[model samples]
Target: MIKYALKCEVDHGFEAWFSSSDGFDEQAAKGLVECPMCGSAKVTKAIMAPMVRTSKEEAAPIEMRQAVAEALHKIRKHVEDTHTYVGGAFASEARDMHQGLTPERPIYGEATTEEVKALVEEGVPVAPLPVMADKPAPAVQKKLN
Candidate 1:
C-alpha cells in the first residue's frame, strides 16, 4: 500500500491511501478523487518526503554505533560509581528521605511500577535509569552490578 499527500486546486491538502502508484494516477485521471472540503476534482500529488524507517544498525554505521554505545556505557559507569544501590527498598527509602525521616543522599534501587507511580503522584522526584547492554532487561527501578 502507498499513501500520498494530495492537494486540490483550491489548495486543500489531505492524505489518501492507494493500492499502488498506478492506482493513484488511475483514480486522479478518472476524476474519482475529489477534495473532501471543496469537492474539487482537480487534485494532484502534493510535494512530500517519502516515509522511511530503519533500524539502529541500518541508520548508524559501525563507527557511529560504537560512539553511541561507548557514551551509554560511560553514563552507566558514572551512575554506578556515584549512586548507592539500595536493592528492593527503593520506594520506602525515597519516601523516608522526602518526609525528612532519613538523610538525603544519592541512591539507585528497585521499585515496582505502582510504587514509582505513587511516588510521582505524591510529588517525589524520580527518573528511570537507562538500560545497560550487559543486563538482560531493564528492571522497574534502577540497579547496577
Candidate 2:
C-alpha cells in the first residue's frame, strides 16, 4: 500500500492510501477520487516530502556522543543563565512576541506538541533547546569577576 498527499482545485489538501501508484492514477483518471473537504474531483498529487533515513543515523563513537551531549548541555546552560523561564506558557508568550503584543526577549519553557505545531504553522520563530533529562543545568556564578 502507498499513501499520497493530494490537493483539490480549491486547495484543500488531504492524504489517501492506495494499493499502488498506478491504482491512484487509475482512480484519479476515472474521477473516482474526490477531495474530502470540498468534494472536488479535480484533484492532483500535492508536493510532498517523503520520509528518508540517512546513514548518519547510525550510532556514533562514545566519545563523539559525549562531546555532542556536552555541547548541548552548554547551550541549555547558557539559556538558563541568560533567558527567562516562562514555564508551560511558552507558546502563548512566543505568539505574543511575534504579534508585538509583548516585548521580545529570550525565554525558555515547555510547550505541548500541538502548541509548537501551531506556532510553526503560523510562522512564529521558535526553536527547541536541548536539555539533559538525567542531568542538571550548570550553576551560575554569583561572585562577580
Candidate 3:
C-alpha cells in the first residue's frame, strides 16, 4: 500500500492509502477519491518529500499518535465551547459571512457535501468538524416511596 497526502480544491489537507500509484490515479479519475473533511471530490495529491526509511523503528511511536489525538480532542473542545452552533444553516451562514451579509464569527454546524463543494467553489471558507462518538445520556434512577 502507498500513502499519499491529498488536498481538496478548498485547501483542506488530508491523507489516504491506495494499493499503488496507478490505483490512486484510477480512483481519482473515477471521482472515488474525496476529502474526508468536506467530502469534496476535487482532490489532488499534495507535494510530499520522499521518506527514505533506514530502520523499522523510524516509524512514529504510539506516544506520538496519542499526542496528536489529544491535540485534536482539545481543538474540538475549544471550538465547541467558543463557536456558535449554526446547525443546518452552516452553509448559508458561512456564505453570508463571506459575502459581508453577516458579521464574521466563529461558527460550527452541519453541512451537506454539495453545500461544502459550492462554498468552496464560491471562495467561502468552510470545513467539517470531526465527529466524535456521542456519549450516552445519564441514566435516570427510580425512587420507591
TM-score for each model: 0.51, 0.51, 0.59
How accurate locally, in lDDT, is each candidate? 0.74, 0.75, 0.76
lDDT score for candidate 1 against the true structure:
0.74
Q: By summed lDDT, which 10 consecutive residues of candidate 1 come out lowest?
A: 136-145
Expressed as tens digits, the lDDT of each residue in 1-145 for candidate 3 is 6789999887889887678879889988997787877777889999998757786646566466555555555567779999999899999999999999989999999777789878978999776665443431122111100
Regions of candidate 2 where Cα sits further than 4 Å from its true position: 1-59, 134-145
Q: Where is model 3 more than 4 Å wrong at Cα?
A: 1-13, 16-37, 41-58, 134-145
Once model 1 is optimally superposed onto the true structure by TM-score, how far is the C-alpha of residue 90 displaced, in angstroms? 0.6
Query: Arrange candidates by lDDT, highest first: which order?
Result: 3, 2, 1
User: Model 3, 113: alpha-carbon shift in Å?
Assistant: 0.8
Per-residue lDDT over 4-106 for candidate 1, one digit per residue giving the tens place of the 0 to 100 score: 9999876879998778989999988997786655445788999999988756434335466456556666677787889999989988998999989999998
Q: Is candidate 2 or candidate 3 better by TM-score?
A: 3
- Weakest 10 consecutive residues, lDDT, candidate 3? 136-145
* Model 3, total clashes: 0
Candidate 1's error at 8, in angstroms? 38
